[model samples]
Target: MSNRNKKIIIYICCAFIVAIIFYLFPHFYSTTMREAFIYFPEDDQIEFIDASTNIKLIDTKDENEYYLEWKTASETDKKAYLRQDIGFIFENGVLISTQSEWREKTKKLKNKVTLHGEDSGRYEAITFHFAEVHYPDDIIKSKQIMTEDKHYVIDTPLSPLVDFKKAKSQSEQRGKELLDSIIDQQLTYTVEGLIEQFKINKESYHIFPLTEIAQFQTEPLPSMSQEETNAVIGRMWEGLYRYYLLGTNTFTEETYDPIGNTMPFVFLSKDDTHLLVLYETADKKGQQLLQLIPKSEDNENLSKNEQ
Candidate 1:
């Protein structure tokens, strides 16, 4: 071949290589990013009680006795709070019996209030204790005046845990449907009504779209430290602002422009005993998850006071 023909072939080869690299780069980057947050089985000493639900059995080998450890996937290496020794009898990986102690010990008190929106109407303000537990100290401090109660409990039957692995693998539409069904099953009140009310009273309710919350969770703010950023990410998996809506007395400064002028909303059971939150996953892949939380009696006096 002549000199010009040889040069043209070399140029074409270089362009093809460039195109291949560009196509593969995003996949490589995304995989690396996801791996950094994943907690491998070898990283921790505890063995999983149920990999489906990400439930770990800590310290004891007895199948009958369980010290259930619960935490976000990102914080698996860190010490997990909400460790409960629920005396459960397991036979071949199935729960055979629930001890009376488990029933009596599961109750905890939750902060409850009534939100009166000027245009949005009235709503029962149920505090998300999960948010308080996982959020950074500064975020907690800013919202402390909203309530004095500080207790967290997970009623497994009412508030079913999510399988993070399953959620990430599912299609976006299926994920949304799964979330909707979970919420609908547990809720005694109407979520549609709450959403309709929020539409008319947007300013009063302070309701925001899921997109804004996703941005807040996935992107680190300029003011945030590494620790704070990690905590926020952890909170996303635990399903606070991501899946559920928290009630506040005053309107927040940030504004959201929801698609079709409609805002996403959560469902609360009667007397705010249960809450169902629908939110996008932390990966921002348009897939969503439902987080169900149930209020338990903290103490005899608190339960009686509310009654």
Candidate 2:
């Protein structure tokens, strides 16, 4: 194909991909899981899976400042998988946030956030799951979580300062409680939003939800509608990092400490299927997926303890 025809083929391919992506809507699944599959787009092929769903995006707005591909489960063919993610960019590096989750055991999973660059040549990206509480509505809930001396218990005692350590600990506990309460309150009150985004996509454009999606026994994945596709095209992640790499750039290797100071990430699933997760960190360059480790068993799968 000539260069002009080749460009036309690319556009036609993108259009067809968008058409397929919007094919599945309003499907629910019995299990909650997502897997990220890496594909070689430049090669015009996908590996490890047959019959994949693809999406091509273009922002008529913003004059095309952002463009990229997201390789994930295809909601249409049900061959794509979904994973809870938390990602953001930071000045020193990216901070991929996470929370600790328990599975009769304990381990970490990197949420959706990613990061790059550090003040020093050294940094580590840590992701894991943590135990947490959920309220029916985002607008109203009692009790909160406060971490004290690296421990967790709901509803810390509130009082004036007694001793500095005790007072500080107590204050931290109160803060957790207050924050949790606020989180619950926002889901129901003036803070609530999202259901509408689903409606228009469902009735008009025919797109589907990426997370919390349900289909037969196939696979579940994220999706997009005309509006969603529109919303995402121009709006690339507004990361706080000083630099970000395009696909062709080189990256440095680094790791972050996954201990006390990291914040917990929480995902509020609207229909018990779709989740809105918030992570407090980012992933370093070249780290695309955070391995999900159950917190018990053993630290057997951890990256051989770098160091």
Candidate 3:
């Protein structure tokens, strides 16, 4: 081949390679660094059934499972029961994404409430709230609440079910208290703050809040005995109440602005075997759930070495 032709062919190959790399870079990043997985209970134990298939997702012999009553009850009698659809996204052997939809219908109120949460790995989780009410004389009402930058951002003409006005008022009052406390004590609300609050040896331990924790808890695995399930959930709430006591570690951290709001609290045992998280629910109804998350294998080993 002529030298000029050879040079042209080389240039073309280089260009093609660069173009291919550019085209694939986003997919690579998204699958690797940008994605996170929920590997708490191992992948095999959890099943993801597509809603369109109408297949039974949970098959347990225990009648005390929360869903059993809803599953067996008649449609008209299923009031106040909640139905949940949870999904996980896995890439390779890691869980990179997860989402859940919960719906509950109350016969007395003649209303339906839905809550959705999607976590696409660290710092990228969001919750959406929706409610619909059917009133007598053929009147219907609906409302939606969404989050922006980790703070609830509600539109005006708020839903009657979710009184954003009241929440805002309460938030303002609590926010002032939080600011005053932080100013009076010079306390920080980050991981560093947690370490100091517990007098933790930073070199020997790691700490984080529920927002930064893994996508799911490691215990209470699916098909757990009814007693076991209750115990785990019960512990979570208990931990929350214990930590939520006034004049304790409770504090508010601002999100994207100076308007402060209550934040989740973490409890790490003295021996570092147990990690409990207590945080408010997405509904913003002053309700919270306690969760116990097992330390990641890597962190556990690191802590052991430091000890």
Candidate 4:
């Protein structure tokens, strides 16, 4: 083959070779399809089920249940933080991302991980939340699951405080302050439709404190005797309570925009892990506010799931 033809042939061969490597070793190969696979138990093979994103917060009558509430400010009028009944599932605790099909791997990272996608958009890096958690059958059946909201928030607050520049700044400041105030504000609400439709007892309801450390971890062990389950769950519960007392809890909400100087995204894990928002500036801030997340993995089920 001529030199040019030879060069073209080499390019094609390299492309085909790269594609094969990507298919087999995606982590070493493909770059854009990073995702988080949260297995309920603490293990490597636990696969997340496919579902739509219509999860709402539940308000609890009993301390065990939970509720949903949204807070935002209005621009035209003074914005109100509206609390309403939405979708909610009972969980020992509460908790995102996209879809990808890359399960059949040779090696495994055994731990329930919160996979964080790097900005390079190359390899997906998942930071584990907890090692693993153990739950009793009763809590699993009784506890409801809480979902997140991915919506736009309105900033209400403009004018009169000063001039045009100050007015703009004032509105921005209000939003920032509001969101800042709520960073540790415990979020609580009631369960959905079941109550409005049926006259349920005031006792069946529950709410979870949305703070920085209200997290519960999933263990590697499956269902066990009630005594064992409660013992384990008890320890986890104690940890969560401690977090609440210290005022160090952080619940995950997608939209937080007050005056815009606050660390907007905070997540409280069931395992008592604290996800915090670190801000770089006071105002006219820079744009680097990603939560510094740690990996809390429960990959004990690693060996069992393989079979």
Candidate 5:
């Protein structure tokens, strides 16, 4: 071949490779990013079972109990089989009993508040099921949990009636402008001001020394809508943590050890999904805000423990 022709062919090849990379990069990124967050089980976990409401009750030897699981699939021409084939979005979700209905066994499932055919929120006294599948060596002793000194509990289902007189007054006087200033100032506010605004009474609420747990940021999982997330928080928790609107972030960095010495703050997400109850110690001299951000599959820090 002529030298000029050879050079042209090389240039064309280089351009084609670059174009292919550009075309394929997005698809590759999307696929890899999604796998991290989605909860699809491996083929080894699938079992043959009858389908009901597009969900299945799988009895795995490891589980020892039958539980509800689901898979998303395309509805099209298919082959016949004794058991339904597992589909795209597979999840070993909430547990269902093999012997009895789950609703009967779940005593805390009572007092459900339904909104638009879904459970909105309610006070349910139920057992928490852990999702971790740990090996024998990795398992912690039950006595260790019982021996832990630091424990907190809700004595009553009802939230202690708070006198929001002080909090209400400040909000009325400051109006919406106060909230704006709180954000622009990066969550700097007077200790007394928030005490009144949120009605945090020593008798009603257990005031704690602001620990690192109260000082982190988080985002909701992608499956949660902002409103749904807010509803979940409101139902599951008590006090000022529930009613905070979007865009409210309050913090004071004055560090104090005793609860009496610290200033309380409200950290709210922009979309109002997540929240943090933080405090500023009396001696610390910086500003902090409860950070609530939306969770995306690609977020490396998305797994932070939440209250």
Candidate 6:
């Protein structure tokens, strides 16, 4: 072959090689990642399970049963229960994500008659309130299940507050567009219905309240102090509680505003084998399902050393 033709042939060979590598890249990366990060538990202890024998926060038929078990469970068992129940369980580890639930209340007034009221010909009124409260079961059920083991979440690479702000800004802009579209079409619908359809679509925002600390390693290090635990728990609880409340309420424009500066919660595991930190910011990809694998001692040490 002429030199020019040989050069062209060489270039084509190089291109073919690059294309093959590229085609195999994702499969290679996925296999490597799964091997490196995924760890399945063998003979794992079942701290809690529903009547059907599936893992769950509580079986709707008998919530009291789980509560009774939890009361006597060791700290380790408690953590395990909460981690699998409320937090995101990957393999052996769990991601302590924010948690929240839906709540509703109805009020009614009834007239009551007493001897004194009858005599006076006056009406006495009694007020009653009924509320709808949910356990972890309801919260998990609402989230989109990516697979048998994965779930979707609205992720943020920054602090939770920043994520909330971005969500709010986006929500407001979307809300305005929806509102404008309604006006343009001159549709006759209830204001609440329009807002419900246009604004607060539950599927889009899986509101997770920061209620539990199962995502952290609860094992206090020898150098760790009770004061440290108290501080961490206290700070985390406040933020989690506030966020939970925000999630429970209707998605109004005002509700999207940032609450304040808050740090993600962290806790030690009961075994002191791992340190779990909550909300290190996550990538917005692949359903945002948080999964964790056991952190080997070497990786843990390396993480601490880097820190």
- Global lDDT of each candidate: 0.27, 0.24, 0.32, 0.27, 0.27, 0.26
Q: Judged by lDDT relative to the true structure, which candidate is superior, 1 or 5?
A: 1
Query: Candidate 6, after superposition: displacement of residue 4 in Å?
Result: 99
- lDDT of model 4 at residue 255? 27
Q: Model 2 residue 51 lDDT?
A: 18
Candidate 5 lDDT (Cα, 0 to 1): 0.27
- Best of the candidates, TM-score: 3
Q: Report the lDDT tens digits of candidate 4 across residue range 1-307.
A: 7999999999999999999988887667323432222223222222222112222232333322233332211111111111111111111122222212222221121212122211111111111112222234421101111123232122233422111112245455564445435433422112222223234332432223332111332322133333233233333333322222112222332223222122222222333323222221123232221222222232233323422
In model 3, where do residues sit more than 4 Å from their true spots?
1-189, 203-206, 217-234, 237-262, 265-273, 276-307
Candidate 2, 156-248: lDDT as tens digits: 234321211122465655655554465335433311233342222222222321111213113322343332222121111111111122111
Question: Candidate 4, residue 292: CA error in Å?
Answer: 30
User: For model 1, how does the per-residue alpha-carbon lDDT over 1-307 read when each residue is reduced to its tens digit?
Assistant: 9999999999999999878877977445443332111111111233223211122323332322224332211111222322111112121111222211101112132211111111101011111121121223421111111111111111133333222222243443354455445434433133334435334332333233222333433454234443343333343333433122221111242223211111234332333223333322112112123333222333223323422
The C-alpha stretches of model 2 lying farther than 4 A from their native spots are 1-168, 187-192, 200-307
Segments in model 6 whose C-alpha atoms lie over 4 Å from true places: 1-54, 57-218, 221-223, 244-307
Q: List the residue pairs that clash in candidate 1.
A: 108-296, 108-297, 108-298, 109-297, 109-298, 243-277
User: Which order, best to worst by TM-score?
Assistant: 3, 4, 5, 1, 2, 6
lDDT of 5 by residue, 135-253 (tens): 24432110000000011111122332111112344433343244335432432445445555555443433232221111111443235554334333332222222111111223432
Taking all chains together, the TM-score of candidate 2 against the true structure is 0.19
- State candidate 5's TM-score: 0.20
Off by over 4 Å in 4: 1-31, 40-203, 210-307
